[model samples]
Target chain A: MKCDFCRETSVIHVRHTDKWFCEEHLVASVEKKVLETVQKTFMINRNDKVLVAASGGKDSTNLLHILHKNFPKVEALFIDEGIKNYRERSKSFIKKFCKKHKITLHTSSFKEEFGTTTDQIVKLDSTKTSPCSKCGVLRRYLINKKALELGADKLVTGHNLDDTCQDILMNIFQFNMEKLARTKSISPGFVQRIKPFRRVSERESMAYSIIKGFESNEGACPYVSESFRSLIREELNDLEFKFHGSKVNLQMIFDRLVPNLEKKVMKNRLNKCENCGGPTSRKVCKTCQILEQLK
Target chain B: MVTLEYPDGAKIKVEIEGSLLKVLVKSGENPEEIIVKKDGKMIAEDYELKKEDVVQIIKVGSKG
Candidate 1:
């Protein structure tokens, strides 16, 4: 159905409010709401530079596009994780999107920064640990470092509600207390990691991508074939369908518990890694350990 | 003085001076599960205390 607000909108759904919305209307709604949330939650000013972490996928691309339209001064950061076809396609999409949007794109690679990608690291030695962990760890380290280097006030991610809830379940299942403590609707860290699309669902993001004709690579990362996170994502999908408002419920739960949880999670945290002197709850930071393991 | 415990069977004594949040972060403690008490009454971390305010960090297990 065509959205009443915008004629270009295709998919329509009504919830919470009496207003019915098509894909365009929903995307616009999310964009507007996201801006309000950012403004309310963070000290975002006109002078503050935002670094949007782009994966060349629908969600990130659409987010960057919408954000650039709203804020007019946002740039993008793309990390090449060295997953054969996946990285290539994602990079291409990101480049095209940036070119179209006239936004500056900064590119970094695991191979360039760390002399390895998740693929190369996993191949160096066979272990039960999937490449996703390495990629995530490395990507996170680089993202924060790069954001700080670029002098960005905030690092925006494209994590939707589905991903957030799935992560909450994963942390719960694994008893990863440290991860759980900070996995709010908006994550907290040395650098502020904001998920403006936290309230938007994966399906809705997909619909928005389709309606907006935004470029997207819908394929799964090749290295994630053995990822436990993917398994948890599948399980969470069923739970989300059976339990309505799961995202909102989780957000509310986090809101009430985070302040306490943060104190608890960091209780065991060490001042600095003994090896690299980076922040950690252990003697050595995870990145330093991973790098050592790679060697 | 604050008593902080870890899952790995470790304990710490925290001296709350400036910001409780800064102290917690500096002590390598989780900012979420910290329990503060004053004369046996639970207090929020952000609450300012008089001289010699005793604080304790509580360890909470994750429900995996």
Candidate 2:
């Protein structure tokens, strides 16, 4: 089949638009949509100091590459979660890419920041809480601390459409309306976070990475399957498979309905954590609480 | 036999013919997270394949 735009053979059938794209067009299409997201959402400014969370996984790697191309002062932050067989390998790809492209790369870790690694957290978590939950809290804490230290104006994360949609759906299932509303709020000591790829699907990013010749298959986080998000992701993907553009449609509805409804929900006023001075709705932040539990 | 190539470098050879989704399910690969191609051109889940086809499967974002 030929691409909807050109004469080249179509390499991807975008079922949502019922359009097809060849390799070159696919690359262009993905980049165009991401840039459009940033512009339409007013996510970035030309002179802003942008810090991207680069995991060296396909999505992050692609995000980093695209941001570097568009912005002048884009740097990368990689938080080592201390996962055996995961973090060590993923770092290499980001490190190499950053070096080759001459982009400044900053890194921190759970061990250095919180006195423990994810591997240790998984073993020490007697409560049997999800490692992703623990790791996420700590990683996020470090990202904010580091981003503030770097004086970043905006912190960019590689959250694609699928991830955001899954998060919204999960929040809905939990009846956590406040949490959904909180996603748009900026807290003290946390750099403003942006998701330029929130409109881009994971599959499109994967295809973009490979087609652009920098795709890295660092494998899944070893503990990914155990998390509830994994289950949600699987269910959502299956739904998308059954109904083309289901993920995109859900996101469209969320973009339209959820935020409007969010205004009715009382916004949280976060206070500084007494223990760590981080922003939290409670007296202590989850990061401090999680570290205390591990200890 | 259709020669199936995976991103993990596993070459799977099987007598498979039918939609890509069916083949992925039978091969224990989740169609939801995979992109299939027949000779470098992306194929949809419903796209049909025949015997002797060289199919490449690219695993997308990692799932648990």
Which candidate number has the best lDDT? 2
Q: Report per-candidate TM-score of chain A alone.
A: 0.89, 0.97
List CA RMSD, all candidates. Answer: 20.3, 2.2
Residues A140-253 of candidate 1 have per-residue lDDT tens digits of: 988987887898887888887667777777788889988888654333335677888777766566656755777767666766557776676555544553464556687668
lDDT of each: 0.68, 0.82
Q: For candidate 1, lDDT tens digit of each residue in B8-63?
A: 55666666565555666667654332333345333334455443555544332111
Q: Which stretch of 10 consecutive residues in model 1 chain A shows the poorest summed lDDT?
A: A9-18
lDDT (10s digit) by residue, model 2, range A235-286: 8888887788898898887778766776787455778999988888889988
How high is the lDDT of residue B19 in model 1? 53
How does candidate 2 score on lDDT? 0.82
Clashing pairs in 2: A225-B64
TM-score of 1: 0.74
Worst 10 residues of 2 chain A by lDDT: A9-18
Error of 1 at B55 (Å): 62
